[model samples]
Target: KERFISLTIKKKQQDVVRFLEANKIEFEEVDITMSEEQRQWMYKNIPPEKKPAQGNPLPPQIFNGNQYCGDYDSFFESKESNTVLSFLGLKPRLASNVVLQLLGQVTVVQ
Candidate 1:
């Protein structure tokens, strides 16, 4: 059972990383296993309502700088809804805007 949980956590973390990379979003991966400080920071930053009732929240917690974005499940939901940028507190770039930018036809107004 423990092994299964470990594999599941790795898969979720990989999914999050893959999504971020595919979108060209810059991110830092923290290894909580290697750093107690980071682990505690993650735990401390998670909101009370988001914590699991039985144990410390698992890995794949998303954050934008110091702000807690959400866990993997929340990330997956936002991805499915096509709101990942907003979910990560990022400015959403419309598909049309991207095409225009590629062609140098217009400047994207933030």
Candidate 2:
């Protein structure tokens, strides 16, 4: 599958401030801008589904040599550490078969 994230947002301190200032309806100066309460007010007005979820949700992130890294598959399963890794088709990268145990049970990965 695809690696980690579907969307990426990068922000720098001053750049974010400048962008916010530019978006402000009547503000030409970044110094005189909206307060936190004002921004929060705007956010609260948005619908629940329209509101931000605030996290990355992606699947089966594979690295070079097809090494997949993710936590979605961790739910519901109880296999031995090495056995779990073997089941996921991760025989090459994991040395000494160190499968990270979860819920005091099944191994997570190689």
Candidate 3:
């Protein structure tokens, strides 16, 4: 059986995000402007680029939080994320995003 899959690159970030979200698809947004240090980190760890044609790079992750709560504290320190982190204030969203940006270094591609 053969299934056809289409991959279209969108010029605008918001439209790309909206399209995936509206369809319940998922993706990681890699910031083209990341510092060298960050790119090195992603390349060293993630294997997606090894076979760019086949693998969909898995977005960085927050890992399983049920086993690690202290891990949550260290991530929400940044000024931008801190705002959302602080507003949510010790709820699941706090932990969710803290891990999302910190370890994954990702912002849900939105």
Which lDDT values do the candidates have, in the order given? Answer: 0.63, 0.28, 0.33
Best by lDDT: 1
Estimate the overall C-alpha local distance difference test score of candidate 2: 0.28
**Model 2 stretches with alpha carbons more than 4 Å out:** 1-33, 55-110
What is the clash tally of candidate 2?
Answer: 0
Candidate 3: tens digits of C-alpha lDDT, residues 43-100: 4443343324664332322222212212222222322364423332234232332222
lDDT per residue as tens, model 1, 8-100: 877876677677668765554445676677677778878999999989888777666567778778889999999987877778652211100
Look at candidate 2 and tell me the lDDT of residue 48.
51
Ranking by TM-score: 1, 3, 2
Runs of candidate 1 with Cα error greater than 4 angstroms are: 93-110
- Kindly give the number of clashing pairs for every candidate: 0, 0, 0
lDDT of 1: 0.63
Worst 10 residues of 1 by lDDT: 98-107
TM-score of 1: 0.81
> Model 3 — TM-score against the truth?
0.26
